[model samples]
Target: MANYFRDYADLCFEAFGDRVKHWITFSDPRAHAQAWHSYNSTWRGKQRGLVGISLNCDWGEPMDISSPKDIEAAERYLQFCLGWFANPIYAGDYPQVMKDRIGKKSAEQGLDMSRLPVFSLQEKSYIKGTSDFLGLGHFTTRYITERNYPSRQGPSYHNDRDLVELVDPNWPDLGSTWPQSVPWGFRRLLHFAQTQYGNPPIYVTENGASQKLHCTQLCDEWRIQYLKGYINEMLKEPLLSHMQMVTEIVVPTVCTLCILISAVLLMLLLQSQS
Candidate 1:
């Protein structure tokens, strides 16, 4: 990941800023802000519109809805996931709370030289408000339950958060293990993003459904139905008004009747030619 970050920076400059408009630097923001900012001028005034990182956000809700600890845990999990990216793009720093949690261990892990990479005063100032818009990739909502510290994951940030995911089978399943279609959760996630990042304009970079289906009669009626239903649910959320739905590559199914008719036509044509 670290090497990829540096390479993206080099390539961004090499492209001379003419070919690229929106740049998403994929790396730990705190650790690589300098390299990223260095490319800003390299592409400036080249019709290049915006530059920012793509973030994967978990929209979390509590599993034990009545448990205060679970509620808090849910909140923390969202903050940890979303805030990690938003803090740098908006606030120009790591979420202060998160730093206090995992910054030390990361330091001892040979990141001591620069556990959370430092941004020069100018770099931080430049990086603040660098986002054209926050791009969020959200799929499903997980029900978070607070748990005791994980069993020896070696001081990782996620481990420190102590969030265990509990899924509900009741949430309409479009047929993936990870994503149970919780339409309301999508709304809640948008609301949280708006409130947390001061309502930065958001673009849904990716959202879609998947079904583990096997061909029995060679009909994909189930897949088509899943798309129709999920899309209906997605459209209900006003925040997703601007969102776009892209159906994955679907191989067209051959109709049995059509195939039979074509075969008969072929036989008739062959007979006439003979």
Candidate 2:
């Protein structure tokens, strides 16, 4: 599978390298690092511009910030989500917590080895520092708590983490199936990325709230508020001064949705001053 993807990427780069300046080998390479690793080692030198990957995560906060278990669970959730991908790009391997827990659980389940694939030292070296910039797509937040799910049910992604996710009822709902407008999560997510990836140049590849389908309303006040709240959090003091940040709002193609453009511009102006 990795070889196939590498071949395809080579073709694209050779065919359109002149026109396409930036090339992303994969959107999220957590589950499949081999392909991106191959690109980094083989095709990266050939490309004229930057090569990177985009990662999507909702920031996880501990249910009990003071409790060690809860804090571990929250960190575990991050290791499972963003760290699952970012660690390889930055640290050149999976998070240590993931390896320890998964390895232990796999042994108890009568498995000889962990389900999570291990990278060779050479491969790890290739993957590390592969990304020129980190692309982040963030929305919503979840309260995480320690929950020891039994591995007897079978080895699965959710059970492996042993955590429970909850959402605050007070958070504003934007009529989506999931994802409430929790602006603080945006700041926390950015901070986590900065700390974990050594403050790599970050681009907010996707950030916005989803509205109900088939709603022909032109005045998307909910979206505007969501954008304002989240962008304002990003522009807060200490954080803004510390990291180089760029936000790109993912807007829908509806012709009547002119309010989104105006709201984004206004927020950008506000962000600049802060």
Candidate 3:
């Protein structure tokens, strides 16, 4: 799979390297790393382009911040989500919690080895430091608490994590399908990425809220509020403002997958619609 992406990337670079200054691929961590290696070794000397990977994860806030078990469950949630990929790119292996938990579960399943794939020492070195910049897509937050899911329940992703996710009943309910609007999660997630990955150059590729379709369709004051809330939390992050990075927020075509152009632009959008 990695080889296929590398070859395809080489073809694209050879064909349009002059025009494409930035490239982002949606692939597994290892495949993404291999694609970077190909870029560096084969064409980076002349291609004049940067390659990055897009990783999307929501912040997992502890249900009770004071409880050690809840805090641990929150961290475990991230390890299973963002750390599932980011750990390899930054730390050169899966999260330690992942290895231990999965290993223990595998043992219970009577498997000789962990269900999670193991990276050899050599493979680890190859994948480390592969990303030029981190493209993170985050929206909303979940309240997490510890759950000791029985290994006898059988092997599964959710069961492996051993945690339950709950949303504050008081938070805004976009709908049964949409994530609840909890802006504070944005700040915590950014801080986690900064501390965990030595603050890689982060691009907020996707961040926004959803709105129900209505007849007027012009005045989505609520969506504006959601954007303002998330963007407010985003600016509060010291690392984000520390760098001269572009903070663009584009509204998603699908509403579920969207972002911000800026508050000014959003106001203009609202004005135009009105």
Candidate 4:
């Protein structure tokens, strides 16, 4: 299957790799890994392009920050959603929280092995570092809390997380109830990716909302606000990134010089008075 996909990819690269600098290699990591291998091994020497996978994930904010259950559930939510695909490609396996939880559930259900896929050491090495860049798609946030389902509910991906998702009543609804206009969520998801993926170069694959309700006169104030808020949040990351090293070098040196100068000034002032 992978080699078949690679043949198609090689054809595409042969035809258009000169013009296209970035390639997604279609959906799913298996195909992506195959494409990555093909590009790096065969074409990358001459073509010179990047291969990556696009991931769409919403921020999972905890309903109650003080509650441990809620916090754990929120983290679990992210691990299940983004980490489901991104983990193997980036970190070489599923999230530990996911493996532990799903494995436990599968054991309770009388399964011999885990429902979640396992990557052998060699497979992990191959899958890891497949992405040249991380393509991200983010929009909204969901408030999460822990919720235990009955063990008899049977094996399912949806039930494995054991969390309930909620949204603030005040957030603006964009047709469906699932994705509300929660601009701050974009920032949170970006930071999570930055931390989780070791600061990979990120290109936001998809964002903004569709005007599903009305488009009579080509007016979309909601979309305008959404773009402004979300783009603003995404742009806010540079202040906290590589700048930290510069700040660490500059701040303490300036503070120490200021303290010494202040002490010298006070001593001179007292001598002048005497």
Candidate 5:
């Protein structure tokens, strides 16, 4: 499977390297280590353009900021989400908490080795320093708490983290079921990526709100607010000046298309640092 992807990437580079300066080998590589390992180490050198992956995650804030367990759980949630992919690109392996927890659970299940994949020393060397940039996709934030599930519940990915997710009631709901206007989370996620991944050039591949499908509202005030709030947070962060933002406005109503375009243009103008 790894070789198959390597071959495909090689074909793409051979065909389009002259025109495409930025090349992303994968989007969210954590779900499949094999693909990341193959692209990062094997196929990366064959291409002339910059190579990286896009990772999407919501910010995890500790439910009780003063509690050590809650803090650790919050960090653990990030490790499980972002670090699971970013760590290997930056640090060459999985986060320590993931290894320890997964190893222990695998042992309890009477397995000889961890269900979490292991990378050999050579593979680690290959994977590390492979990314030229980090692509990020962020939306909303969640309040997290320490919650341990019984082993009897079986060994799924969610339960292994030993944590629970919550949302603050005070956050403004912009029509989406999950996404709330939590700009702080966006800032935190950027800081974590820079600190964790050695300040790699970041591209925000996705971030936005979802409105009702049938609602033909021309004036998307909620989405405009969402963009302004999130982008303003990014502008305030010293570490996030050169990042790119990718967003889509769902304009089901054709008459309101001009309004959506104007809103996006306004957002871009406000986002401009100069």
Candidate 6:
């Protein structure tokens, strides 16, 4: 993958430029610039459509917010997670604090570079405004604080980012174990993305809830409610639109067979009565 990242820019530029209107590059603009700066720098002059990366974002709120520190901590948490990814695409560097924080910890973790990634001057210049659209893939939300922030020793990606953890108190605990239903957080997250990232065209690659119990008698009212809230929040602005939802459900084979047998039995009973 490293070798591919190092070399594929020229190949992709030649092969894809003709048909590709817009290109979604990499999650790291620094790395993206190093790879495609040559292609993108002149591609614009040649009338080629621009490229950008799809950043993964988890938008959420703080669980404990009574203290002022908690509020600031929450903001910092979100900024480090989502903003750290978006800032380089627009501002051309990882947040200064993040760089410093990671730098201090890298020695202990045996990291080669600040796990945050590096940006070259050419790459920075090339990556800025490279995104024709800001592709964001948001799945769930997390509550955060400074105390909750973990060091590089922690296993989870968020922990490595130095963010404390939390969950929405009121969010429903259906579908998946990790995702709580904080539909309001989705709206807040979108607004943050708009305000922070120049309101670039946002394409939401994934957004949906998980499944609960599987039975005809079991109502999916919870999922329906979650959908209503999330969709309303996303559709608030006419211009902010993106992917169509593709829902995949696994209907049990036993359930299908049971329905077929029930239909056949009902028909036989009705014919005998007639």
TM-score, every prediction: 0.66, 0.79, 0.82, 0.88, 0.79, 0.66
List model 2 lDDT by residue over 1-274, tens digit each: 7667777776776777667766666565633455455545666676656667788899999999898999999999999998888898899999999998888888978998998889899988877877778888998899999996544557888888999999989898787777789999999888888878898888788898776556786868888999999999887734553334322232333433677788899999999999
Q: What do the candidate models score in CA lDDT, each in turn? A: 0.67, 0.80, 0.83, 0.87, 0.80, 0.68
In angstroms, give how far residue 61 of model 1 lies from its true place: 0.6
Top-down TM-score ranking: 4, 3, 5, 2, 6, 1
Candidates in order: C-alpha RMSD to true structure: 18.8, 14.3, 15.4, 3.2, 15.2, 18.9
lDDT, candidate 5, at 213? 49
Q: Candidate 5, residues 171-258: lDDT per residue as tens digits? A: 9977658687899899998988887777788888889988744567586877898899999988777634333221223333543887
Error of 6 at 122 (Å): 4.4
Model 2 spans with C-alpha error above 4 angstroms: 30-47, 148-152, 213-216, 237-274
TM-score of 5: 0.79
lDDT of 1 at 36: 55
> Where is model 1 poorest over a 10-residue stretch in terms of lDDT?
244-253
Candidate 6, superposed: residue stretches over 4 Å from native? 1-3, 6-17, 26-30, 34-48, 64-66, 106-123, 148-163, 213-224, 237-274
Whichever of 1 and 5 has more TM-score, that candidate is 5
* Candidate 1 segments exceeding 4 Å error: 1-21, 27-42, 103-123, 148-152, 211-274
Model 4, residue 131: C-alpha shift (Å): 0.8
- In candidate 4 the C-alpha lDDT for residue 20 amounts to 92
lDDT of 3 by residue, 87-148 (tens): 89899999999999999989988999999999999999998898888888987889999985
For model 1, name the residue pairs that clash. none
